[model samples]
Target: MPTTPVVSRRRVMAALFTGVACMNIAMAGASTAGVLIATESPGPGWSGVPSAAGVLGTAAGALGSARLVVSHGRRRSLLITYGLGSFGALLAAAGAVTGLFPVLLVGLLVLGLGNGGAQLSRYAAADLYPDERKGQALSAIVWAGTVGALAGPPLIAPAARTADLLGLPGLAGPLLVAALVTAAAAVVSAALPRSIPDAHPRTPETSGSEGFAVAFAQRAVRGPLLAMVAAQVAMVAMMTMSAPQLHQHGHGLDVVGWILTAHMIGMFALAPLSGRIADRWGGRVTIFAGIGTLAVASAAAVAAPTSHTAGIPLSLFLLGYGWNLVFVGGSSLLSTQHRKLQGTVDAVVWSTSALAGLAAGPLFALGGYVLVAVVAGVAALIPLVALTDH
Candidate 1:
């Protein structure tokens, strides 16, 4: 067994983390304004665009992942993903200028592709370190995304200002910023050590090629997949309604912003540690904790906003943290379970998640806030029951 080049576990983790966050910065900005832009040009049709775009992105990402795994390999695939991400940003900026809804949709689709691919690349974080520390490393890489996540919406303010100068909405500015972040991530990837798939040539466990069927059959992979899908769907469903829900309860947009910021803060704050816990205790425990937290949070939200402004934010924060924990924990497990099928399994997982979001989005939009939250909360618990038998 050849020893991997020794690097600062912390530095490698940090670099990957920055790399992941940078990839999404643009999309994050666009997401902040997605509904508004949709409503402006397309009217109510815009209401469905975000979730639809999410589905397209997930599908594209699945295809992109397979291609990356086959041709460029993991490291190069990440670089390609970064480039695509940046191009998506540029495309989005252009759409904002011309008011071309189709072009905007196309750009969003491409951005989705990049998002799918960049997120899948996080699984490769396990490759950068020895097996023993893999979970922690994966968590660290994901934790880095928190930086971009936080920056995504906030960056919109300045971006909006910049776009206004160009006679476009501020939305264009964030796309430009996203492009810059993607470019930077690509540069960093160029410096990374080559990525080795979990399945090595010498290992008997290496199955070589993993078609969709085999990947789906694995319990370890399936467990986290369920967790990811549920958590993600719930998160998006809740998030989509955050502004309205807060408003219904008499909270303003500023208060809504505070809730979102707090949610993101909770998500990243515990990620690295969660990763370490996954490494120490295993993915199942962390996932269990995450699912439990989400169930509780959902119940709190269903209870409705109270006089305590902090309650919703606090619940959302826990939701974010719980989501982060489950995702990283599940991702780590999936990486190991189907080493040869990493990309395939990832595609399946994310695509399933995307579809779930697609189904949940409008339902939430039409169902109103409380129903969506309750349904998502209740749904998250289903995986817990099904997977415990394993």
Candidate 2:
């Protein structure tokens, strides 16, 4: 295996970290604005459009960015991705100002593309480090999201006020902030040097779907990818639809916000520790633990009564941690794959997550939250059972 110089690797890692953190800041703010945009329409017909568009964009972005990475190297590909994000944010802001729903959707879709590029940065970071160090590096990048989660929300009102001063719609303020922040991400991404010793050879992956098929046929690729996908499906389905269940139970938006905060803490706060666990115990054990925790969390949700809000939050926290473990562990395992396949796998992960989210409402309505939790649990078990062969 090749080795990157420690200094060079660290510099690139720091760049990826800063870029992803900034992108998330934009994402959170834009997401809030998107929800508002969706709600601007009467009734519940369009409530989920913004999120759906973003997810679909993320899926497309991941595939497109990965191809670019194959042909153009990390730096150039990242530049294009984040540039798209910034432009998308600006377009979305224009939609807000003009009251054009289609424009807002298009902008969000583009912003999600940029976000997809940022998501792939974790893989680029992995490529810079040795096998032993990949977990720590990936975790460090994932941990950067905590900064966005903490900082993004507070900026919304101020951004809205700033927009008011500019004579734009108040919601456009956050989108404007998103534009600036994503452009900063583009700048940070521009600073990434070729950290790989044998960097950017333009692999066969750029050729066509055949390359992806061959790569995915490998045992190493299949296990980690499947585990990662399961984690995503479970997490998105359970988490996205939980709010409706809370609402049905008469819980207010404040309670929902507080619970989601707990979930974010569970997701991002202990990422370094999660990385350590993966590095120490190996991916198989880490994924097993993750699956177990997720299954338990799902069961807990079913067991907890509506009035028992405390239990619900605890379950959500557990859900987030479970997802972190699966994702971090699976990613570390997948790190050894060909560079071109990285973005492709992530694209599939996001697409599956979007589908799960779309199905969540219907699943929840069928048997209420119980059915959704059951479905998530079933999804979690797929990789668990299959990876037993690993």
Q: Point out where model 2 deviates above 4 Å.
A: 36-42, 154-171, 194-210, 242-258, 303-309, 364-371
The collision pairs in model 1 are 160-170
Model 2 accuracy (lDDT, Cα): 0.78
**lDDT by residue for model 2 over 156-270, one digit each (tens)?**
7678888899888888988999999999998888778843433223345443445778877877778888988898888877776665667567755456556766666677778
lDDT of each: 0.67, 0.78
| Reference-based TM-score, model 2 | 0.86
TM-scores of the candidates in the order shown:
0.87, 0.86
User: How do the residues 241-346 of candidate 1 rate in per-residue lDDT, one tens digit apiece?
Assistant: 5644554566543455456667777677678888888889988888988888888888877776452376677778877887887887787787654444665555
Residue 82 of model 2 has an lDDT of 94
Highest-scoring model, lDDT: 2
Q: How many residue pairs of model 1 clash at the backbone? A: 1
